[model samples]
Target: MVSRGYKKRGVGVMGLRHVKNPILLARAMLEHGEDDLEANPRGVNSGDLDVPSAQGHTQLYGKAAEQLAQQYELELVDPSYFFTQRRWDEHVRALEREKKGQGQATWSATEYLPQGTCGAVALDQDGVICAATSTGGLTNKLTGRIGDTPAIGSGFWAEEWAEDGDPTGSSTWDR
Candidate 1:
């Protein structure tokens, strides 16, 4: 699975995975004392934490994940998103191809991947594990836009064990 450092500080476990649905979670946090809505109107951006991508939707996913965790009473752990570095590289290559007049001329065609993927893993206090992912199909991506995020076993995985036994079970998901 691909991994990267999560930078939005103070996005504790609560801010990370507990707040599923970035937009909704952000609104809730603003009502509470957990987050500053005004300062971060667009949720948390990638640069706030040094991750790549001109933008990062981790906060949005985190919020949605958090709501699910709480609704299910699951103990939230390190909530994160994984995207293939190759996919990003491919996006760049596509831009080059377009620059060479081999592809579409639209700006969105070059600025962002036609689609993106994300995943989340959660564990309960008793150690049950759950994995989830979100993504849009890889339609119309430039030749270089590799769509690995939705690939099974390549995007996300999780493991957990019973308190009194061997590993209880594991859950995995693809976009």
Candidate 2:
């Protein structure tokens, strides 16, 4: 609930992608007290952050977050941080390049596949099945290109459907 959660009392999100990175979480910890908001994950530029072994990202963030949280300090992560003027300018430049038929795909020697979603499927006691997924974005994709993770049935889907393909169970929207 990063949209407005930091303002509330005793409210925090876990595994929720950070707006930029650990700085925000550190700020929250300082304001709300570390005990109120226990654990959270923070990172930046998730769009192109797909390495073969993701632990590298994890380890890097852990060190940064611990330092920031301990001192309630914040630091600029350069172009990676959200809303830096330099980064904004670079985004505009990239858009212009793409419009002119010039775009770079892979960032480095090792190009990872576009696999971003973390998913879970559940079957309740009543036999109702549900699926949920979350993603940061595709790796090495165009800057603003939204990945398939949120594409409903394509990315993540569940539940029974009738012969005609409509949902089998009651839905409030039909009213």
Candidate 3:
């Protein structure tokens, strides 16, 4: 999802869950959030097409759900307009260089990203399956980069299976 905040400053933490277990993570995230900018930057040289919504600091856990109601622009580029203008510009320039194949390339995107994450896939006594994931995402990640920790199928998934063994579990992607 193209996470964005309608204000110059907002939140950045993201969560995706198929069950209620992940709410715990959200509660914890709320406690750790800090004041940060949360605007959809414009005019940036989004050479890689990954425009970040949060600059300097990814909002701890606000403004993500708003993406659902946000109209998908045909080509949302340039992560500018953030409250920390200087930092946003520097990062965007790096992103542009990366797109031009002149910036650092030895490390994969995940290497520099925040690695601490929590995920759960559980089957309860009632045979109910649930899944959820939590992450702050890359505090300094490339714009618009979707981390596996929050992606539905790629991060965490859960499905119920029949005792007959004729059925298989599925993810949101499969559905």
Candidate 4:
């Protein structure tokens, strides 16, 4: 979303959507919230969110994201959009290791994997601050394993504060 010349929202991922570029998804959400704020000024409501299935160990968000994309008139791609042979093989190997009581091996591999959690922070010319992150939890994680990547504040955050009525100025410090 950074290269798109827009920076106004924060987002994080946790094995959901499986999109190759999660920034696009985060951008969409930011736009969605912007629209809501424009209309209500108070921000979006819970119902406005594209919540995923409340019950599901596998946590397939592709369908959910697709639905949201359709609603927002955004482009949608096939499952292969985020598919890769290396990732698939790694997932399979991790699963095998997990079944063989080698969960640590799977964790270690994920720790070093190049495709793990990602995050970004940006400040636009207009002073807009945006932060975002995305990740497909450790490869072959347990069925119910849910990481903090998808949770706001836990994975990423963006804040704006002014000191002495001047945002660009330094504030008085207290011990």
In candidate 3, stretches whose alpha carbon ends up further than 4 angstroms from where it belongs are 1-102, 106-114, 165-175
Estimate, for each residue in 1-175, the C-alpha lDDT of model 2 and write its tens digit. Answer: 1111222222122222233444255235434452443333444655432222211121123334444334344443443443445445544555565566655432322323334346666666765555545555443355545455544446555645335433855555554
lDDT of 4 by residue, 1-175 (tens): 2212243234322344535455665566555543433222222775554542222121224445544445455565666777788888877766777678754554553534676667777787887677666665666556757676665555556777655554555545531
- Give all candidate RMSDs, comma-separated: 15.1, 14.6, 15.3, 8.3
Model 3's alpha-carbon lDDT is 0.40
TM-score of each: 0.27, 0.32, 0.35, 0.61
Model 2 CA deviation exceeding 4 Å by range: 1-103, 107-116, 161-175
Candidate 3's residue-wise lDDT over 1-175, tens digit each?
1121222121223433221223443322322333323445444674423223323433333234323112222122233422355545555665766667765533445335344466555555765555545654444566566676654345544544445432455655456
Candidate 1, which segments miss by more than 4 Å at Cα?
Answer: 1-100, 103-110, 113-116, 142-146, 161-175
The deviation in Å at residue 21 for candidate 2 is: 13
lDDT of 2: 0.40
For residue 98, model 2's alpha carbon misses the true position, in angstroms, by 12
Task: Report the error of model 3 at residue 85, Å.
Answer: 20
| Top candidate (lDDT) | 4
- Separate clash counts for every candidate: 14, 0, 10, 0
